[model samples]
Target: MDTPLSVLFSSAEDEKYVLDCMAYFMILMAACTFVCLLFKDASYGRYSSSKYGFLVNAKLAWFVQELPAFLLPVCLLIWASSAKSSLLANQLLIAMYMCHYTQRSLIYPFLIRGGKPTPFLPFFLAVVFCTYNGYMQIRYLSHYADYPADWVTNPCFIAALSWFVAGSALWLLGWLINLHSDHILRNLRGPGESGYKIPRGGMFEYVSAANYFGEITEWAGFAVAGQSVHSAAFAIFTAVVLSSRAFSHHKWYLAKFEDYPKTRKALIPFLV
Candidate 1:
């Protein structure tokens, strides 16, 4: 009996080719997303509209859509033949990928307070991206990634693995910033109060989308640490989407409040 993986990739070379194609596809998707967002705001959260057809509960949608990214890697490692998973370099890369998804899938959604429902189309599209990306990143790391035994220690591989050691600090800092920014946003409303309020302190003082900045930084650092085309593509995709979202958020904040700060940028500090 042929398994799905076997059917999709007959040999290791085939798998590598497919993964390369997928990374390029992600880059293309990122470009298309940026172009599309320029014309219309994505229908979710403050931008949610009825004409999008159906809406899914925000928490449910978040968890369900994000779950695949968390689960698929585990599935690939356990059931699929992943040769490099035991290697130190691959293990570290997989660990970094898992850490982000674990927080995203398990911890983030349930913490929501009066969050807006997601449009069905957006929710569905998110699921597709998660499923697609999860497979691409993990499959390559676990199965196709080939690094030398001293990749992490050798000066020659510093371009790839040394960055993993160096970028780990940046990744950790971004993760902490992301966590703190989310905490600030969640606590913005009082116990009984409703609706959005201007987030203060943390990254909020400098930018409207502090959370967005943190996540983008997180992935940019992840790309450096990962030193793979797939990770780089993902980081690009994250910046394009989140930066656009942040700009929308900045526009909304400026339009809604007469007292909004004039010096604050959208996604970046001091400059957009």
Candidate 2:
């Protein structure tokens, strides 16, 4: 009695196992992020603190975050250039994780701008989980799964490429919007300013958290590029988490500033 469920499960035990592992890893990552945020809040002692002053040093924080991201891409390129299918998959997975690490490592610190350093414990845990899970994803892709190199040349590949390109363009545009907005906000604050302020202009005009919007877009692009269930799951998780953050930020902006832009929505622009 082979039920459909049984058949589906039986056919790809390894893929299922990999997916399960990834799911668990995502859950762990989410937990780690939450814990880090909690620690950050406790250490910073609320968002109202004027002692450390508001506004972390953007340049310094950016440098810290960018270091790993820069290095990881180089590693990915080297790995990707090699012809082994398993290694290629592994490299792709590593590249995905590295992309994420680069973003989290580089972006969050500078974005804080003067809060207590996000609790090191949670941050450290996240790093560990990402590193480990990323390794596993790569290992499975390289060693366990076999995919065609011309996977990219198939019709599915063409479609996936289209999605990837479109998604990537949107993602980059979102990033630019966020980056420019951040620049504007930073300049507005001047030197030695502390505390979060309502971000104005750019996508901030439409959404309270443009930077987050961009971040989500970036990962969504990756998911599109991969065109796999695993990639889609990661992107979905990222979107949900980031969207929540965007909502929270939006509410905070509305509460904190009388002059906060009225036109902008929370996570979506003029929609949600």
Candidate 3:
């Protein structure tokens, strides 16, 4: 259990109840965010607007906002009860979580070029989300989550997949897709140019929101591997949030590009 909230939960059951409540809270917030975004786009990136408070440097915003997700899990592991933190499965799960955030918070920000400043309110909200989700994920894994002994090594099928190997595989695939998609977007503009251009190659050939698709795949995989309500909620929340952003991007492209592929969809390839 997280030491700061030790007083709030007297027993394992109490801790679970608190976690469940937090998950529910996230879902409620998701609902509200979805409705709000329907009326107006989020105030960041290309949608950056002065209405959402002063802007912050995009790289700085991303780094600071995403840092908590990486930092808190480490703290959770260090402070966790030895019985929970010592499990190989738990360590692997945490590693999977860190793999994404480390790239987002540390690596991705620096790779950005000529990115617009992010509005302050959105940055603050991102920080809160990272902290909330970081605690929900790592705390559960470190102190509450359990797994079957054979989950990691079960060989009942396909030489190695009676376990949850499929989920891990999906996570890795999604990570690679995300990297590739980002690369495509970054190279869309030539040196000294300052306007948006149609992203080509890779999955962008199919969908306007290829990067969003990649990220959604990632957390969906995490949810599958973790097999916990917390993971599921996170996955669902991610889908709601990103799908809306994807819709916005798709809408923007249609408006901005007169020759935008009429056949190309928003987030999904054909169905969306």
Candidate 4:
């Protein structure tokens, strides 16, 4: 029979195995997104060229796709026991993640105005990603991660705390920018008016894809705050995917409008 120590060691090995799998999965996901970008932009927004196999309402798609990330993490936190340590820091980190997804899945989707239909393939991919990512993040934080009891007083924690606060501010700023930019795009047409227009005001005045920039900023902040492999993986994935998306949108705008703003960058403020 396995002793208690053997069982503990086995559990640690299992956690390590799961983490390794998640890392590999993230790498593969990033590779696939990069390879696909070389051929065609994502099949959403102005880039939807060929018809997809299936379609769903954009609002419903967003809610359903993002729900797993929020709900799964919460479920994990509720059920998993911390790894023989006080999990104050981990709980805080989880809260921050939950805050973003709560707004995204439960609230923001419902507030969308005149959203375009989303394809089932991308929607389903998002669902899988959310489940995978959510479980990885929450599982690590809730059960595997541990900090020293005096970590708050440690120099490293102090530094990380600064980053956490700064990241939180950046996240809030990005959220505001994204929300306002989307609002601008949604209001571009009203009551039978159809077609895209050059978005102006706010960050849209500077960058073609202000919303993408905001989301990138938000994730960067998240990485800084969490300071974990999982968070860094997520941030890198966001940057890779959204940067390509922004480039595509920028190119589309330039092609569509002869008088497109020459000064506007693709994803950055001035230089991209």
Candidate 5:
């Protein structure tokens, strides 16, 4: 049997490279954390006075947290590919990274129909966590893992490719649903809105937090394609964190909107 990739790190150069990558990764993460804090402060105001105990807009908070987390993997893929000259893995990883960022960059800002930026505390926490995980991921990928030279030609590779394709399709579908829902709701409210209300139609018909659900699915599919513990962990973390947020939103919706959709589930469809 092939030895697990984790047991493959045997060289001093590999170890040193991993350490260097980790140190740089940490610095980058710190910068992202600082930026997030600044955005949080500027966008949401001070954390103490906010209703949700932070200054971020509720709808945008999930992306704010996810953005840095998304960056770490991309950075890792870039560094690993450059250092190791592994064209196939590097390209695949880059594609995965770009797929996520493309959606984030193109779709996220517009999704904020209207709300303050995320609160400083949650934003800060997300940055820190993402940075930490990013560092860990780069460090590990640099030394401890290996993939097939003909990874793209392999059957498993094809399956992973399919997973990626499916995931991407789902992500796009979710994005459109999220966008439409936000559009409808935004037009309905017509700016200067506050407080939670029942978001209807689109994916919201099936899940109360359709946008969050889309985001979670997108990351989860990315992880499935990459097939890395780091990626999987990030996906799982995204799911758990977003699920909690969805639940919070669900509860808030029910409390605030008397006629909220009783049929919709929180994070999942047809299940909790």
Candidate 6:
């Protein structure tokens, strides 16, 4: 016998049911993330070990995991019928998501320099997450979601648009910082050199995990702009995961480097 949830998911016609399921799943994921905070995900950088069994090149791992976020949306749009005269704002929001994933999946992985091997487990988890999230966001925004025809001139819409603009600006700024910070970390080693170095300059002067901060900020802004449960869930997830990683990185830095800056925080500039 087909369960109600299973039937809803299997049917292409029940878009609302699918989105509700996605929302519920995100809520569950948020709870799971809280539990996961008690234990670190054992992959990436110094944490990488053979305990998880089997590893893939970091670049390959990142590319494959992130690919679904970019590709699934494109595929969905091509095959799924869209609402006629879809709001321009919705289209732009979809573009923003695609832009972020395009960079993450295609550009950022290639830019990585001598990254540590990623364990198969975490890599697989990431792929599943990206695919699930990509489908939820793209399908809702492109096909099912609708806005008032007068939304462009409505005061609420105007305010939401402003919120989105502000969020996008913050997101873009954070992305630039993240890219620059990654570049600095990548160059910390020479052709034959392989070891950790205290990252200096830019946001690193104040925070041990500047790139993490940038990413967290980016998604948080996206959530604010998006003003949807789906976006909010993603933002919360990012914050929880990245903040945990930043704390771990901070602890590792403190233990490893005797001359590490005493004033620098973990993810936040000075608060955390």
Q: Tell me, by TM-score, which candidate is best.
A: 1
> lDDT value for candidate 6?
0.80
Indicate the residue-level lDDT of 191 in model 2: 75
lDDT of 1 by residue, 29-51 (tens): 99999999999988999888767
Locate the minimum summed-lDDT window of 10 residues in model 6: 1-10
lDDT of 4 by residue, 119-139 (tens): 777777889989988877777
Per-residue lDDT of 81 in model 5: 37
- Quote each prediction's TM-score: 0.95, 0.63, 0.92, 0.87, 0.64, 0.90
For residues 169-271, write the lDDT of model 6, one tens digit per residue: 8778877888788888888878898888899988999999999998888888777777788777788888878888899999999999999998999989889
Local lDDT at 223 for model 5: 63
TM-score-better candidate, 1 vs 3: 1
Question: Model 2: which ten-residue window has the lowest total lDDT?
Answer: 39-48
Shift in Å, residue 84, candidate 2: 4.5
Model 2 residue runs over 4 Å out of place are 1-20, 24-113, 136-147, 153-157, 174-178, 181-185
For lDDT, the strongest prediction is: 1
Q: What does the lDDT come to for candidate 1?
A: 0.88
lDDT of 2 by residue, 145-203 (tens): 44556553467667655665575565556556556765655555657877666666677
lDDT of 5 at 46: 19
User: Candidate 6 regions off by >4 Å?
Assistant: 1-13, 149-156
Residue range 1-272, candidate 5, lDDT tens digits? 21233246586466656555654555554455455543333223212345545466645665766676566665555544334335466355545555655555446655656555665765677667756665555555454435566665677678756765676566556556555655755655645766545667778888877877877776676566556665666666666555656776677678778888788899889997
Cα lDDT computed for each candidate against the true fold: 0.88, 0.55, 0.84, 0.78, 0.60, 0.80
Instruction: Compose the digit string of candidate 3's lDDT tens values, residues 29-60.
Output: 88988899889888899989878899999889
So what's the TM-score on candidate 6? 0.90
Worst 10 residues of 4 by lDDT: 1-10
Between prediction 4 and prediction 6, the one with superior lDDT is: 6
Stretches of model 5 off by over 4 angstroms after superposition: 1-86, 102-107, 134-145, 155-188, 191-195
lDDT of 4: 0.78
Q: Would you give me the overall lDDT of model 3?
A: 0.84
